[model samples]
Target chain A: MGGDFGPGITVPASLDCLRNNPDLKLILVGDSTILNQHLGENLSVFKDRLTVHHASQQVEMHESPSKALKNKKDSSMRVAINLVHEGLADACVSAGNTGALMATARFVLKMIPGIDRPGIISALPSVFGHTHVLDLGANVDCTAEHLYQFAVMGNELVKAVENIESPRVGLLNIGEEDVKGNEQVKTAAKLLENSSLNYIGYVEGNSLNAGNIKVDLIVCDGFVGNVALKSIEGAAKMISTLLKEDFSKNIFTKLAGLIAYPVLRSFKDRIDPRLYNGASFLGLKGLVIKSHGGADALAFKTAIEIAEIEVKQDVIRRISEQVEKSLTLSKSA
Target chain B: MGGDFGPGITVPASLDCLRNNPDLKLILVGDSTILNQHLGENLSVFKDRLTVHHASQQVEMHESPSKALKNKKDSSMRVAINLVHEGLADACVSAGNTGALMATARFVLKMIPGIDRPGIISALPSVFGHTHVLDLGANVDCTAEHLYQFAVMGNELVKAVENIESPRVGLLNIGEEDVKGNEQVKTAAKLLENSSLNYIGYVEGNSLNAGNIKVDLIVCDGFVGNVALKSIEGAAKMISTLLKEDFSKNIFTKLAGLIAYPVLRSFKDRIDPRLYNGASFLGLKGLVIKSHGGADALAFKTAIEIAEIEVKQDVIRRISEQVEKSLTLSKSA
Candidate 1:
């Protein structure tokens, strides 16, 4: 994985991955010493399945993506992406620096055919179970066409991940009206309305969390999607903080907390960022799951599971077919 | 007030406003019959203080700002703005259509001297109390200059409403780094850095909810602010829904709920959106409060109290001073 916390998180995740999927193979592409220190005495069972490749440098999270890729030849992120490029690894997962990971992926794996930009697709745990929020942090300034492509990619991803036959796709707009939002959103609505996908025109921001809107996939510019995703996380954090403060207020509240403990735990588990950290750097040639950098073992294991599923589903191949067909039709039209 | 619910909410709020400030005079501007119908028996104590304007047209929530203003000549919103325009009302408070209200205010009251777009400013309840979030739903395609003006306006509003000195204003960017985010954010950051205001430079999306980023005021495009605001509401709704579902799951949980009723009520009271529904449409010539349309009497009362404080503080004069200074400096520079 291409991240600052590559081996720190990956070591535990690798262990959990092997335990959960006995046949899974893991190639540690970071500094062998650091990886071994974490791996330690538990390396006996998966010795045959594990391979260590020495990658000396680690990319800092704040480093410029292009500069990091250019300077750090043996960086863990670059090494991992190379492995995927060379067909040595089925998929690559990272919780490290997002920009560096995205940059390296774009540079090494390259964009899939007919894809304009490699959008980051995140799964937000909505009331309707799960909604795929696309372009969470990929294309900041997106056009109408870019959003259209995002819908296509997001739709394909929903199907691959959620096992939906035809996941409903909604264009994120200011309102449900035919004419709402900025020029880009208005144009995107028109394009989405004309698209072959299960298009549910414009959707308001409230529909995302309410899960009242039946769409499994919601597409928008990275600016809006990223803000929306982070806002939800921030709100959840704020609410949890408030609840904790309330519970710790007095003896009565504390005692009440004991009684309400199960419900609070369920709330935490349901909206936990760690549990829902398997974001894909979608539209890339190879499968890449970007888990939260601070994700614990459970979350990391989930990311691995997601990666494995994407590989089995031949997600890239299917996406390529759909995108290419759509592109060809657009060109002809 | 400019809204339909203003009469319903304002009648009780007028009492609270009067109780707090005996000198407060409420010119209830709406359909006289409807206002009296709602205020019936409760009008005795403050019957002498209330003056009604018979406005017939009510702007629908879905109507376009311009269309609503052009078509609905005798709208309560239009009349409310006109009161400010003719120097009859100190401010206009509304729980009506935000778009129509904004349009009416812009057309009648006009922008404060240097303000390009009068932003919709409101204090969003954050983990760390409250932060002033501007452009809640006013200007959509905001330029950097527009955002800078919003910062100035937001800084003034926070000072007026919250009694904070030198409220640190932050430009809502994709990342905190000077190098991150789209061109608009970058441009806005530069303007903020160079401005005379207490500009804190860039802040991330997550910071808006985290309550850790210690800035009193945050300025961004309406799209980002609206999306972020709605997402927070969505998260809260989703969690609340989940909480209700889990509580109603079994007899035991239901029993726990009954036992912890008082504590839960306290928790609900603390986080209730009803108590925090007064959002000010900043940058106009006069103060305009936009309460939630679904507001009850309690929320409406709070809205009136909010309006009283806003008018007492002379928010418009303060905003005018800041904007005038900004305009003169920019022109000379």
Candidate 2:
């Protein structure tokens, strides 16, 4: 009902997640006939842990967010999110149109008190394991206040998910210098500096992947964050393409590639984007993870695992308390 | 008197350029003693083509752009730009502080007739040869009008430097849809659409390095452009580091790496950043190129070659004419 493959990908990914986690239960929200067809023969095997919540409609990948929000009231994405809001489900995961998912999530789940907007936070593969980045196309034109909120949410996510007591949060800017970025960034820096969070001042774009400077969370407006994330993806793609083309250019290189296959495979595994597939919609009242639309079964399973982790960690409650504390501190001051 | 290596890198790079292009003459502007020391006994060998123009001061790498413009009037960076202003040189190339160089160039040569601000354009290695992107940290807070000017300048640059009659100009955004980006980007897209330039609507960040979509020039605000460029550099660095670590994990992998050395070298050579070292300051009355601050002798020579090409192609004059024509057309409409 979502993503490129719809039930074809999600059904199998759900089964894999159930296999990996004994306590996990999944309610596939889509046309019951198709969901049951995919969940075939195994229906009786997993009947206790798996169920189908029939949805009347589906959202297209290219559909406008507002249009989907207005028309697709019974879409699988909407039904899944509704289950979360009704307290029937701990979290919702979707590999669907990003804009539509976000719009519907905002409309249905609403925002957490003291938070103005919902930010999409995702972990990117970095030198030291990985670093979490936020506001990845959630709100393109964000105010300084919105950016400060993003920093807070990103900080809490890392603290809860990664088990860090006090995560070092860095505001993404063009330069480390105090005078380097635009007015929005400068104001946001001031807000983060005064806050009680472990703010680490400014970090440049290169700091995102470089190991020299360690940062737990990188915060920026959605516009800059989206551009930076996509640029990294493009670079990784270009490097892989170039490597393949070079290795297959002739017979000699092909032999060398075959010899070096083990080392190359390990390298690819370390930097694989699929391993870091899930993106959380933070600042919302309920947990919702967005998997890559073109993700395979393994990648989508990763997204489901991320959702399970967040729910177990009570990420929503932690972020809500932090936002309330910061707001109260500012008001009293 | 600029960059990390100063005359040590620039002097040798200048000699290499002089050796390669017999018709080219270079004016080395810095402290006479240091310049002569680096020039060595070669001063007599290329005496006619290379000469030192003494400057009393040097702009430190960390100096503020405004401070450098005001207090360092006799700085080497300022004097070199002054030479271009007075028509003593066809173009100026510097491995100096970007802020100092851009500020001094703007102060001395000023902006072109119909352009509001100067943009920094550099070529990025893409699947289809290379793509030129502009406003790479020149104006962090740009208006819609400023973005339009960047498109015009970037368009003119590719036309002159790459010899493309009509470069496909793409406005960099988070999404390709008309309603997907911020207000400024949306307004700028309209301006580009109605203009005479070959505007190809909006392009996402992945389009920057992806080969599927062919774009000659990508235009965005300086803040976005700088972040995108640095993100690519960070990703490339991360991939290379991972490759190195993977190849040296064990004796078996090390042996395999040795066998694959030739293929790896060719891959590295194809994506080397040195080949695209120079970034032009477009929409200025005179030409100035900024080389990477940590560039080696070989990389510095590439910057000089870029400057030579721009001078020969009359990029400044072409940009000025294009700006004037666009302004006239908009006013009439």
Q: Note the DockQ of each predicted structure.
A: 0.70, 0.80
Segments of candidate 1 deviating more than 4 angstroms: A1-6, B1-21
Q: What is the lDDT of residue B168 in candidate 2?
A: 94
- Docking quality level of the chain pair in candidate 2: high
lDDT of 1 by residue, B1-333 (tens): 344555656667766676777777777777889888877775677767767777888788778888997899888888877887888988777788877887788788777777778787777677777877888867669988888888887888788888988888887776677777889889888887887789877877777768466778888899889888888888889888988888898998898777677777877788787777788887777778888777877787777777888889988888888778886579577
Per-residue lDDT tens digits for candidate 1, residues A1-333, read 444456667788888888778778888788888888888877776888877787898888788988998998789888988999999998988777888888899999988777789898877788888888889978779988888889888888789878999888888876667656899989988887787888877776776788466669999899889888877878888778887888888898899889988877876777777767688888888888887776776778788888888888888888888888896579578
TM-score of each: 0.96, 0.99
Candidate 1: the clashing residue pairs are A2-A77, A3-A96
Return the top candidate by DockQ.
2
Q: Candidate 2, after superposition: displacement of residue B10 in Å?
A: 0.5
True contacts kept of each: 0.66, 0.75
Q: What is the lDDT of residue A109 in candidate 2?
A: 95
Q: How do the residues B103-128 of candidate 2 rate in per-residue lDDT, one tens digit apiece?
A: 89998999887678888899998877
